[model samples]
Target: MEEIFAICDDITILRDGQWVDTRPLEGLTMDSIISMMVGRELTQRFPEKSNVPKETILEVQHLTALNQPSIQDVSFELKAGEILGVAGLVGSKRTDIVETIFGVRERSEGKILLNGKEMRNRDAHEAINNGFALVTEERRSTGIYGNLDITFNSLVANVEEYKTKSGLLSNKKMKSDTQWVIDSMSVKTPGHETAIGSLSGGNQQKVIIGRWLLTQPEILMLDEPTRGIDVGAKFEIYQLILELAKKNKGIIIISSEMPELLGITDRILVMSNGRAAGVVETKNTTQTEILELASRYL
Candidate 1:
């Protein structure tokens, strides 16, 4: 927005694939722009968080990735109904923590405990079966099958659930689940048969998130969940996260955005050069303290 206001002479607003208006950028405020983009007055930038932290549900102890220059001795506990934010600088290897736990990245040394039992998530399939889900940082590259339609993308994560007695995928069940993803996530698409790649970044992200939700994961990890999304879409995603947290789902969000972490999370685990620098209560810690912790290992 700062960049848009500084240099762009004219601004065009698009809502649900239709052009709302195009005019000079001179008189537009951030709120006005958001209003036009979402087709409504967005009363709040972030929803009022109502999730209360509960008993510890996931524990990562001495979690060190096998890959060099990655997370080391990163220990944290995620409670049911808690949003735990991971904050760090560019090279802090913040994403590595979730990837290792998700089993996409190998773990050299660590113990992952869920409900007081050790979970050996040796691969992505094992991780999913163990009630863990991850929304990777790069949606274009690692998140979605761009060429596939919404139905395929939506049911792909938990496709086994749609298998019939005859060893064939049930199109009826698949359609129902796809519709659920579209409706629950508020994904704007022409139809379930539309290629997921053709949708806007925000809509695509919504579908990806919705896809993960079908698995009914105990612990949900998101890496830069709203990186390329608009403010309106970002707000929607925030609400979804909070709603999940309210349902007692443990959420771990890794973000480079300080305000995002501060705004939504109950607590934050600061990362410093691939290490757990410190954990702070969001209400008590300022960006200054987080930055200080981020620079600790440097």
Candidate 2:
């Protein structure tokens, strides 16, 4: 329906010496005109993901290597405001799948698309730049910096955007944003200056989610977001996730808890080994299917 495009016109103001503009296009659309331009590179990117009238998610269609311990030749699509749950036991590759989507890990085959457009593989930074965010499972090690103050940690992911001078962050902006998230998420903290080491597990998890929300990603990858947190806090997180969906953010939640996934996801995906074992409608399927899908790891 919508046309996705990239601006790749390069007249090359500087020749070899590099004294002029050499930036590539941010978005390129492959139209009839564009097809006339190169048309040969189509084989390079394979099936492109920019702009189309389809309910498909630009499925990643690479087979799981025979040696790998997971499903093979699986594909699926996700839509805006949809909450998809990935349910599997530890080592089932659920986390690995989401991590690869967030660029924390690598994938040998398959493609990823946003709104039907092929996604660029530029690591986590590229994914974030293209409106994707990740809330890591290892929150303590990968998501948050325990040594920093709560306020600093909350805003560190977005400090550069609030820079006042030549790359120097504006502390005031950071403090205000951090405070906003704390209040919005109902985080229990002394203030922005509180050390992260002092917060409870639930509060700490809230901070991690808050950090990613500040990036304004359209699609959020959450890995074990509710793991090891209090029941009340878990409910709050579920509410937040639902709220995010209501706001039209595509969410991929990697959760080990079966009830939690049943309670939230629009659909469920089960991973085995490093493969997508199955994708089932939430209401039509039961936990039995989830168990069967995850059993491949056994």
Candidate 3:
């Protein structure tokens, strides 16, 4: 909204695949624009922080990836029931941190400890078995099966659970879980057989997140979770994250939006040149300090 109001002189509003209004930006406020776009009055941009941090559940000690010019000697601890935000500029390798932890990227040298025990996540399969789930940055390329239906996309990550004694996938279980995703995440879809590619970006993201939740992971890492979504959708995602944190799930979010980090996370981990620059309490740190640390190792 800020960027649109700043750069564009005129604005066009769309609602439910139909055009709402097109008018000049003069005398227009964010609330007015958002109301028009979502067809509802959104009172808050972000939900209030309510999750309380608990004992440490994950520790990354001197983590380094195999790829050259990537994350090196990065370290941080995530406590159960906490929301940890990763913030950095473009090309800072913010996504690499979660990828490395999730075993999407190999770690050349590092120590990952879960519940005070060493964990070797050498591959994505191993990471999933170790109770770790990641929602990748590129939804089209890595997150969802665009051509597949909602039923397939929602149950793909945890398909093993839907198997019957005959070693075949159960259609009844699949339909039940898919319906749960739609209802719990508020995903708008005509039916479970609807192709995921036809849904909007926000609905696709919600389906992906719901899919991960079905796995019951101990650690959840989201990369740009709310990107390209409307304001109402972003607010719902934020509330969902907070709700998960209250359940004692450790969540790590990587976002380019600074206000989002400040609004949702308990602590902000600033990355610089593929390294862990610094970690600050979100309540005590400002955007200026985060930006300063982001450029520290440049």
Candidate 4:
């Protein structure tokens, strides 16, 4: 591949069925090529951080999932208005820890405390009722209703809030709230009645986050929030995360991207083979230090 590119005089870059500029390989370096592909410099990926509060909002003690015992004895405390990032390589069982805390996975041994009160391992509904919301990693399969319209997808989590005294759904409140979500989140859609599947990946993610926000969660756990989105959309999502933290929400983020963790998080909890390797303040830690910690248990 290197020899072919070296011998070639001209190279054509085709993206999304559209022709990009044909440039000669003589002056086209990898960095310049990438810049052309993304339509911007690589330096402006992550947004600025929001200030974090001091009070602890959620605490997990010695958490071990029944189905995933690899995540053993993990414990952490998340403060209100803080962006706490969870970082690890693939198969580190990072997903298991959050799922257990959110009651998606059963906990064999653990204690979850929400503002100093012990939460029982009932289920996801119980977790949600107690001010916990989890935006799962698999957004396409679990998060959004693809065939449904934006209004249905947005109000599905907290549909009861729009109920009238007659026990029927109120179209007025539903429309109003849906419009508010669309506007507040800057979701790109032709109309509220447009099918969610027709929207872009970034817009779908925005809608999903909007749905969870409507539930009024105190602790918001996002697993790989910006996994498949484009660069521009990723920045928007990062900004939204910071905005949420500004509102005093304890945000727990699980991302495989170390730069993303370092860029946006207040503190990063580095996991090694599902165990807590180390917790370091993002401002004081480097990517090399995080990788070192993440490889400790292994």
Candidate 5:
């Protein structure tokens, strides 16, 4: 369905037996790989299985025989040091896919593998424990802790590691860590001891991102990561995302803006109707292709 594909990060493409070299692909997916990821064949077992059922594989096989998805066989992979953009118009289900992967939404029928290990559908805690983090689109309600101090909010995701020998939090170390994140992420704040509520929208978003980074995630899912922040702040956040990818952290970014994806990501995944509509390599994909994909939902 459009929901899933709309948020998918595109896979790298190979032509004439050589890898494309412009920007390394990020959070890329191959058709065969995606299908195989679900234990099915590329074409025969893929099409009709878009809205994957929770029952027997045989039933799924019967559906795939109908070729429901109907998209061509496409594939790509993301390289370290690059971003992968997932784009679509509203109602295309892009956010749904990202949320499901982050455990904010349930995944009733697919296997989620992180760093080659299968993931369990427990809760957001399990997702974080497996080194996955999401900076959701609704930042105010989802990512921030407005009433908490800078240090408290930044330490929320990774608090277990900061517990003292007596099981009490070490306020000193916590402050030190918060200070470090603020300095490193270039977050503008009166003080790391100040309330997150006192900061501007940009600063608040930075705190949320900082908190997720505290967990040292291997894969980061950012849905509309830079929506309302100012242009300068957006650039800074983009830089941070780039650095993480360069360090080999797989990043999946969902945004309404096409240029953001085309400008920063190595490839763009086009989602519509709860499934991937199409995928384009950043070097090969244009804003027009994105428009075409977004048009499907209309």
Candidate 6:
């Protein structure tokens, strides 16, 4: 979440039951909100991702989800190291599109090709096994094991990878892998044994992303990665996304925020009512143009 700044002839900030600061909106950016309000310096800016897409790694053709006719005739291609953004209004079936591609929502008619080979993923496990990972939009309700500790939550997605030939889990490998994610993702907690529910929303999100990364996915789909977090955490998540792209992974992000999607993605797939309205290059497109296409089918 960003700090709410009001603009008129002057800008005003309301914080802690009092008006904190008021200034002209001139020369202001969303980036400065953290320091002006929280009294902490944001040390790192988000890294830039390259726009030149590589080989096409995933293709969805004329896809339709079972029992969900709203997702009709959806098609797109994602290249290695490219960040694709999906945007639409509420009830636009944005979530349904990603879930169908990741195999959580059944596909009634469509073809999913990974490296030119057709994949029929009947369930989430099959998707994971096919080198795909999905970080669902709803974290507390559907993504995480709230009562479980950080270790369990972090390693749960790749549990099968740590199983021995005898079919027993290797706790040592699990803890080691979990530590790597904590260090890599910078997930803050008192200890890895701490309950996931005890952490703040941002850290919880980091843990959720870490869990999906453990699956060693070639395609990573994130639905609203920064929904309820502060701006600082959002920057961190953006950096993580760039880092993933640096590894040549295909990243598909479904976000409601136009700026966030336009800022980070290479190309955007604007959905309207339930169909693919347009796919625009992020570098050349404006929010006005995106919104126009987003409302086409509505």
User: Best by lDDT, which number?
Assistant: 1
Which regions of candidate 1 deviate over 4 angstroms?
none
Error of 6 at 161 (Å): 1.5
What lDDT would each prediction earn against the true structure? Answer: 0.94, 0.71, 0.93, 0.86, 0.66, 0.86
Candidate 2 local lDDT, residue 92 = 75
Give the Å error, residue 245, model 5: 1.2
When superposed on Cα atoms, how far off is each prediction in RMSD? 1.0, 21.6, 1.5, 3.5, 16.5, 4.4
Top TM-score hit: 1
RMSD of model 1 against the true structure: 1.0
Decide which is better by TM-score, 1 or 6. 1
lDDT string for model 1 (1-298, tens) is: 8999988999999876688999899878988988999889999888998999999999999999997989999999999999999999999999899999999999999999999999999999999999999999999999899999999889889988999999999888899999999999999899999999999889999999999999989999999999988888999999999999999999999999999999999999999999999999999999999999999998
Kindly list the per-residue Cα lDDT of model 6 for residues 128-175, writing each as its tens digit: 999899988998999888999999999988888899999999989988
Cα misplacement distance, residue 104 of candidate 6 (Å): 1.4
Model 3 per-residue lDDT tens digits across residues 49-105? 999999999999999999888999999999999999999989999998988998989
Candidate with the larger TM-score of 3 and 4: 3
Encode model 2's per-residue lDDT on 194-272: one tens digit a residue.
8886787778888888888999988888989988764546766887887887777788898888888877787898887
- Identify the superior model by TM-score, candidate 1 or candidate 2: 1
List model 5 lDDT by residue over 209-238, tens digit each.
Answer: 888898998777788887876444566677
Model 2 C-alpha lDDT versus the unseen true structure: 0.71
Name the better of 2 and 6 by TM-score.
6
Query: Which 10 consecutive residues of model 5 have the lowest summed lDDT?
Result: 56-65
Task: Evaluate candidate 3 by giving its C-alpha RMSD to the native, one decimal.
Answer: 1.5
* Positional deviation of residue 195's Cα in model 3 after best superposition, in angstroms: 0.8
Model 5: number of clashes?
A: 29
Kindly indicate the candidate among 1 and 3 with the higher TM-score. 1
Give the winner by TM-score: 1 or 4: 1
